[model samples]
Target: MKVKAIRVHKIGGPEVLTWEEVEIGEPSEGEIRIKNKAIGVNYVDIYYRTGLHQEPLPFVPGKEAVGVVSAVGPGVTGIEVGDVVGYADTPMGTYTEEQIIPATLAIPIPPSVDHITAASVLLKGMTTYVLVKQAFKIQAGHTVLVHAAAGGVGSLLCQWANALGATVIGTVSTQEKAIQAAEDGCHHVIIYTEEDFVAQVAEITSRKGVHVVYDAVGKDTFKGSMECLMPRGCMISYGQCSGRPDPVPVSDLASKSLILGRPGMRHYTATRDELLHAAGEVFAGVAAGVLRVRVNHVYPLHEAARAHADLEARRTSGSVVLLPAMPAADS
Candidate 1:
């Protein structure tokens, strides 16, 4: 049978995202065919589309999606047909009406969580989980700085860290985003375009500096965010929306015994067990009201090109998900 999906033929602008029909054969052993309900649009997709990340061209480029099992192929038993599921796994084919995903990667969604919310949360929520729960382990009395506080991962990170009893300090480019970040439980916000976040962090921490800095803004905020960290503090440069962070001098690392490096949700949840554990924490947080998802935009799957345009143009405020041609009725 055939399915509709967004395909990128060559590296370029958002114009590269094209919706086309492609054949989808029955799933192989250990795989399951899914009828997509909703799909998440992440900044990483833009990086891939523009050749910044350099994936194979003429590809379907999406990582997170929510759907229902239409057919479970041979050797799959746990997830039966009609089961709702979501995933943050690879293969980059979620921008579609249907997909064949590995059974190992899909996680069953609870009845309380709708497909759109599940799709929206899978990638961003897991990123936040790894940032707070895995990397630095945000705990009581810790002050943390999150760059791009109004963006998808930042919005959730602020609230999650706050719930963990840490004071959340967010950096945003605009006054509106600053307000949004503040409202999302951020204890403080730095308008990075106007003020030096390093200075603000120093003032906020009484010159002691924060315990950790969660930086995804890359080149633009790397130096400043690092400067705001205390001795032996950890700096996680997880994403490079502004551009990849440059090499840091070994002397700088040794000078303050600073801990800094880049990491991703892929490594953090590499194994199926790890993925399940991370998803469990995320769902629990959402169920308990500790984490609130911010879905700011939803475009039809065919309009994925426009979605990418908005994301790359910095015209989006929060999470954006692409809805399938026929959205499922919440059950």
Candidate 2:
């Protein structure tokens, strides 16, 4: 079948993303064909599209989506046509209306969770779970600092950390996003545009500093994030939206005896059981109203170029979802 998708032949700016028809074949052994219901827009997708991440020439660039299984190929089990499933951190090529994915990557979506919600949160929510539960182990009384806290993964981090009884301090670029961060459970929101975040975190923590700093902003915020960490604190650098940060010298970390981790969902949930465990927690959090997905940005899949542009400009907050475009009316 020929379907509409965003394809990248050469990496560059958002303009490189082309909405065109691509042919898809039936799934082979151990693979399932998915007719996508909704797709996620993430910073990682931008990375691949911008050459920050390397890939073979000519490819579809997307990592998360929720869909219905339309065909189950040979050797597949426990999944069938008509089942609603969601997958994140999978092999790229989910930018289209339909795709073929490994059976092992599929996670059953609960009936209570809507497709858009599932698409928006799976990748980001799992990343948040790993950051809080595995990377640093947030606790009650622990002070947490989340950079880009108005963002997709950042918002979930704020909410989850707060629910875990931590004092959450978040940083955003604008006052509007600061308000959004506050509503996401940030006890204190810092508009980095007006105030120095390092100074603000120092004041918020009574000069003691935070136990952990979630710094995804990279080049611009990395050094500042390090300064905001308490001695023996943890720093989780999972992204580089602005640009890659300079490598830290051992002596720098020695000054504070700090622990640094760069955890990715792929490593945290490499096994099937691990994937299910992380995904299960995320879904449960949503069902319990603990993780509020701010699907604040929604666009048709064909408008992906515009979506990328808006995301890179920081005009989007929380989760950004791309729905499959409607079929053109017969003319």
Candidate 3:
């Protein structure tokens, strides 16, 4: 079948994201074909578009989407045709109208969760689940500092950490984002554009600092994030949105008795069971109102380039999703 998709012929800017028709063959053994309803837009996609994260040329640059199973491959059981499913773990090629993915990676979306919500939260929420619950357990009374708290994953992290009975301190660029962060369950919000986040964190924590510092902004916040952590506290550096952080010196950790981890979803969801467990927790959180999935921007699938530009420019907040069913519009 020929389906519309955004293909990257070369790694460069958002303009490199080209919308074209591509052929998709039938699902092979242990694979399933999905007709995407909603596709997620994330910084990782931007990494793929540029040369930051290397991938083969002329490939689709999306890792997350929610869709319905159009066909099931031979020997695939438990997942049937017409099941509403979402996937974050991948073989790439998700920026399309339909995709063929491994059945093991396809997670069945609950009836209560809509396709938009699933696309918006599956990847981000699962990341938060592993970061707050698995990477560094956020116990009650713990204090956590989340950089980019108004961002897609950061917003969810703030809420989930707060729900765990931890004190959530978030850093955002604008006052508007500061307000949004507070509403998203942040106990304290720091406007990093005007204030020194490291100093603010110190003041908030009474000069002691937090139990854990989740720094996804990478290069820009890496050094400061270390300063915001208490002795023996963990620094979870999962992303490099600002740019890859400088290599940490072993002596630095020794000096502060600090722990640093750069974890990825692959490690957290190494098995199908682990993937389901993390995704299930995220879905449950959304259903129980413990976490809110916000879709702040929506675009037609072909407008992915514009979406990427907005994201890279920091013009968007909350989650952004692409509607594959909608027709492409002029830029």
Candidate 4:
């Protein structure tokens, strides 16, 4: 079958995202073919497109999507045709109308969650789950500082941490986003563009600093994020949205007794059991109303280039998704 998708022919700007038709054959053993309903647009997708994360040329750029199984390959068990399923942290090529994915990677989406919500949250939600639950083990009375608080993962992190009885201080680039962060459960929202986040964190935490700093804006905020942490505090730098963080000196950690970690979702969800456990926590949070999946932007699959531009320019607030089955009028 031939499927429409956004293929990256070269590593460059959003223009490199080219809409093309690609042929796909039947899934081999232990694989299932899915017809995508909605596709996720994430900063990692931008990294892949801009060569920040190296990849083979002329490959699909998406990493997450939600769809329905149209055909199940031989030896696949527990998943039948027509099951609503979603997958994240998988290999690229999810930018298509249909795809063949390993059955182990395809997870069953709860019937209560629609395709758009599932696609928007699966990757970001799972990442937030691992960060707050596994990486830092946020608990009552803990204080957390989340950079880019209005973003997909940041917003979820703020809400989840707050619900866990932690004090949440978030940083944003604009006043509008500050308001958004506050609504997302941030007790204190610092406009980083207009103020120094490190100074603000000092004042907010009464100079003791936070228990942890969740930083995704790398180069621009790395030093300040370290300053916002208390002694023996953990700094989780999971992404380099601004740019890769500057190398840290080992002596720096010794000064404050701080611990620095760079975690990846792949490692957090390496085993099948780990994948299900993390994903289950995310779903439970959403179901229990502690975590809300906000899909602030939606675009047609073919307009992926425009979507990337919007996301990179910081025009988007929460999760952004692409609808593969969008009608011509919407496009």
Across residues 23-124, which tens digit of lDDT does each residue of candidate 4 receive? 999989999999999999889999999999988888998999999999999999999999999999887888999999999998789999999999989999
Which residue pairs overlap in candidate 4's backbone? none
Question: Which regions of candidate 3 are displaced past 4 Å?
Answer: 327-331
The CA lDDT of each predicted structure is 0.89, 0.94, 0.93, 0.93
Q: For model 1, what is the alpha-carbon lDDT of residue 47?
A: 87
Per-residue lDDT of candidate 2, residues 37-129 (tens digit): 999999999999989999898999999999999999999999999999999987898899899999999999999999999999999999999
Q: Candidate 1 at 30: error in angstroms?
A: 0.5
TM-score of each: 0.96, 0.97, 0.98, 0.98
User: What's the C-alpha lDDT at position 200 in model 4?
Assistant: 90
Model 3: per-residue Cα lDDT over 86-130, one tens digit each = 999477878999999999999989999999999999999999999
How many clashing residue pairs appear in each of the predictions shown?
A: 0, 0, 0, 0
Identify the leading candidate in terms of TM-score.
Answer: 4
lDDT: which candidate is best? Answer: 2
Stretches of candidate 1 exceeding 4 Å from the true structure: 326-331
Which of candidates 1 and 3 reaches a greater lDDT? Answer: 3
Off by over 4 Å in 4: 327-331
Looking at model 3, report the run of 10 residues with the lowest lDDT sum: 321-330
Give RMSD (Å) of candidate 1 vs. truth.
2.2
